[model samples]
Target: MQDMLVRLLDLPDVSEEENKLFEKEGVVFKKPITPEKSIVVDWVGEHFSKNWADEALAAFASLPVNCFIAQREQEILGFACFESTAKNFFGPTGVLPHERGKGLGKILLIKSLRALKEMGYNYAVIGGVGPTSYYEKVVSAKIIEKSERGIYKNLLKHSK
Candidate 1:
């Protein structure tokens, strides 16, 4: 998989509209505090992958903790994190399978990207991208040429 680049300054302002939709569905977007770290990590592990959970753990330790969550009356529906696997990286985001298409993913993504922009980043690298069209449509992300395998080249594999 190739990496993609997003010009943070060119991102569209969709948080406001997305927030309204989220509020209507009783979903709240927020950054996890110290006490909520374990809860968020556990949820990510269960709903996404252990790899993402590990990345979320790293995000929790960052200077400003570049991660966000979507919850409704206490249950986590989605999460997005940046500067976890690497600095100026936006990734490891996912929404629960059952909760897909509710716009939670987009909201979480925009919120996280906005945070990156606020952190003085002019661009963000969406490393090892999965859904190319989705990222392109949402943030105008462009593929970094000849970047197949990007930073995951030496990733270890488990033996069966």
Candidate 2:
């Protein structure tokens, strides 16, 4: 997959979407605290992959933590993280299979992108995109040409 570039200044405000999700679905978005790092990372591993869990662990190393999560009370529904694989990069986000199509992915995405904007990035890369159209539709992300062999090109595959 190719990487996509997002113009941070062009992102839409998602406050209303967030409010609606909470009022209707009871899901709340939050940045996980230091004490909750292990729980969050483990959840990512169990639901996604060990690689994602590793990246989530890296997010915790930041002062305020570069990870954001969608949860309903004690259960985490989804997560998004940035600055874990590279600077000014947004990614490693995923929602539970059953919880998708509820706007949680989009909300988590915008929250992370907004965080990148706050950090002074005019543009952010959505590395190795899985849903190109989704990124384009949500954040006006454009494909970064010649980025097929982007940052993860040399990634080591897990042994079977």
Candidate 3:
């Protein structure tokens, strides 16, 4: 899949929708604290992949931390990270398979993109997108022309 670009300035207001999910599902959203890093990484590794876990670790190294997570009653349900795979980049996000229909992924995505905007970025790149339709519908993201593989053009795969 190709990478997508999000114009941060044109993002729709997500607070109301996010708050509704929070109230109805009791899910909380926030950046993982230093003490929660290892737990978050381990969760990502188990549910997603080790590579994404490593990127989450890099996000923690940033001053304000570039990752956001969704949890309910102290159990993580999903996560999203930016400025990990690349600067002004949003991704490596995933929601638990069981929680797919809820708005958790949307919350995590917009929260991270908003964070990037607050960091002075007018636009954010979502590298190597998987759910293209989701991004397009939620943030009006558009695919970057001829950017299939994009920054991961020469990515090395692990030998099994």
Candidate 4:
């Protein structure tokens, strides 16, 4: 098995100001979901295509999930949603627009992995991810499947 890190710990210790900013003004950590807050969730679907939003929302709703919101004083910085499959596997993971490349992605990804492992999943697989090689380096994800989307290549993974 590739030493793919399926089980991980990604909780970041928030700086006091960041904690206060989130606590008193906005959401800092993971919390329960409600439709009201859904409006605040920004997916880059508009960039990819208007339909991307619905697709992302649909996938998030279909699985066992926990949504994380990162805001600083009521301004939404980023968010990530995690979903688990029947075999204790974690499926689709997403980060909102304006949040890419920040340390938050890595944090949420690790935390989600850790949670799935705790739920008794031995591995986690992700499909429809672009630039699979990038994730492979950061999280030790091994590609188990691949597909083509026009000129783009999509990768699937089975992580340890």
Best by TM-score: 2
Where model 3 places Cα greater than 4 Å from the true spot, the runs are none
| Candidate 4: clashing pairs of residues | 6-160
Query: How high is the CA lDDT of each candidate model?
Result: 0.86, 0.93, 0.90, 0.48
TM-scores across all candidates? 0.93, 0.97, 0.95, 0.56
Question: Tens digits of per-residue lDDT for model 3 on 18-108?
Answer: 8898889888899989999999999998898888888999999987788999999889999999999889999889999999988888888
Please write out the lDDT profile of model 4 over residues 1-160, one tens digit for every residue: 1212242444334355455544565546554355524553344243343333443364356434344545555554554444522233333444555656655556556555666666666666554465677567667776653233421233232232
lDDT for 80 (candidate 4): 45
| Candidates 2 and 4, the one with greater lDDT | 2
Alpha-carbon RMSD, each predicted model: 1.6, 0.9, 1.2, 7.5
Q: Write the per-residue lDDT of candidate 2 for residues 45-82, one digit (tens) a residue.
A: 99988888999999999979999999998999999999
Instruction: State the weakest 10-residue window (summed lDDT) of model 3.
Output: 151-160
Worst lDDT window (10 residues) for model 1?
A: 151-160
Kindly indicate the candidate among 1 and 4 with the higher TM-score.
Answer: 1
Question: lDDT-based ranking, best first?
Answer: 2, 3, 1, 4
Model 2 / residue 14 / CA error / Å = 0.8
TM-score of decoy 1: 0.93
lDDT string for model 1 (22-111, tens) is 768888888888888899998988777777888999998976678999889988988999989998999889988898987888888888
The regions of model 2 sitting more than 4 angstroms off are: none
- Looking at model 3, the pairs that clash are none
